[model samples]
Target: MNKEALKKKLFTEIYDTHWLKLYLHLLKMLDDEDDAKDVVQEVFASLWNNFDAISIHTSFTSYLYSSVRNRAINYLAHKKVVISYEKAEELRDVNFSNAPDIFLIEKELAFQINSEIDNLPPKMAAIFKKSRLENKSYREIAEELDIAENTVKKQISRALHLLRQKFIHIKYYLFFL
Candidate 1:
């Protein structure tokens, strides 16, 4: 069989063998059906993408379970950030008259960042916008733009580097969350 065929067979077999167990494990841990499904799907997608280079120091079962666990942890971390941001917004509303300097700085920094994004080279700006704003994957963007995936990755990296240089002061606040 050809490389693509072999890869597909491997993925299909592995997915069929472990998908249900992973989904059930995640569902029990997350206690939300949709979130569990999303995490499982993301883990399988990552496995497919990285199959060629994945070195299983342990068994494949162990690898997949570990991936699912890590993804779930990351999902929970992101939810925490969202919750914290929402709480901060609520506090800001309660103390509107005494708003902190940091909030004002954040607002200004957001405007500056948008302006810098607009100033990026056209192709780079387009790729960055699709990836960041539209949440399109690099593969999707490359397919849509008829460019190589590596080119899309490079453009985004360059755009981020330029923006980081321009907004180094607010990097922590903007990038992490």
Candidate 2:
């Protein structure tokens, strides 16, 4: 079938019949109603654009579900980075009574932390921010991210290990004092 014809058929058959199911599936994955709806819309738009290339044997519902899952994950990851940057900025403004050198060292440490966070894989970055800066419980972070609590804990642990490696010099710098 032609592109337009397949799009119409997919839209009419898959969308009309399964949109609610798709949205609910996304909602479960995302844990946010509005985000689920938004992801579903994006999935459909992508389907329309790529209709000609899609194999008929590929399960459309599965593809839509996976698309929504990935988009929601990316959205959550972006949000975590924004929150981390904002928190870092807030920390920078705090008054420190230490000597000028000490203040400068603290500022440098904060900068290094932020840079390491920016370099993390998306889910690891989000997990680190939510658990460390936000002080969110592992259960809460897992629920929000639709991941297992063990996964949240592991990601945070891994992030901390990477940050420690990245800033190992900080410890030596302190020891020289």
Candidate 3:
């Protein structure tokens, strides 16, 4: 087939077979329909731009999923700073409210959670932060840390177990209060 014909055929097959699934996967990750749609557009655009170098061995679905995930993570990271500032303003606005005590309790709980997380092993803590705070998948975390995906999963499990033990003790202490 001619280069044009091959490109068109590949595009048609990819879109027909995988577009909706890819979009839905991205939508779930991003929790925003519009953002998912935008990412899908970018994914296809990148494929089109690099069409000449594209290999048949590449699993288009995997490529699309990974690209969308990375894009969503970048979007969330950028929003984190903005959201933190907004949360600070909201906290300040509520500081003198009638439920000030409730707010204080919430702040204390948050502090405790942070302290528990900080006590985790460094690698485990990093994996937990990447998975929970950064919303990265195990595959992404493993790739970033240069470890196996199963290792990342196990580290997170270990972190959770430690946190649970810590919280159980905290709860016992609270009961004595």
| Winning model by TM-score | 1
Residue 135 shift from truth in candidate 3, angstroms? 41
Model 1 alpha-carbon drift over 4 Å, by segment: 97-177
What's the lDDT for candidate 2? 0.82
Question: Tens digit of lDDT per residue, candidate 1, span 12-63?
Answer: 9989999899999999999999999999999999888888888889987998
TM-scores, all candidates, are: 0.53, 0.46, 0.43
Output the better candidate (1/3) by TM-score. Answer: 1
Which sections of candidate 3 miss by over 4 Å? 55-58, 81-177
Show how many residue pairs clash in every candidate, following the order shown.
0, 0, 0
Sort by TM-score, best first: what order? Answer: 1, 2, 3
Q: Model 2: C-alpha RMSD to truth? A: 17.4
lDDT of 2 at 170: 79
**Residues 1-177, model 2: lDDT tens digits:** 996787697677877887898888878877888888887888788777777677755676666667777887887898789999999877655533334477677788889889889899988998899888999999999999999999998998899899899888878977654
Candidate 1 colliding pairs: none
User: CA lDDT of each candidate?
Assistant: 0.91, 0.82, 0.83
Q: For model 2, which pairs clash?
A: none
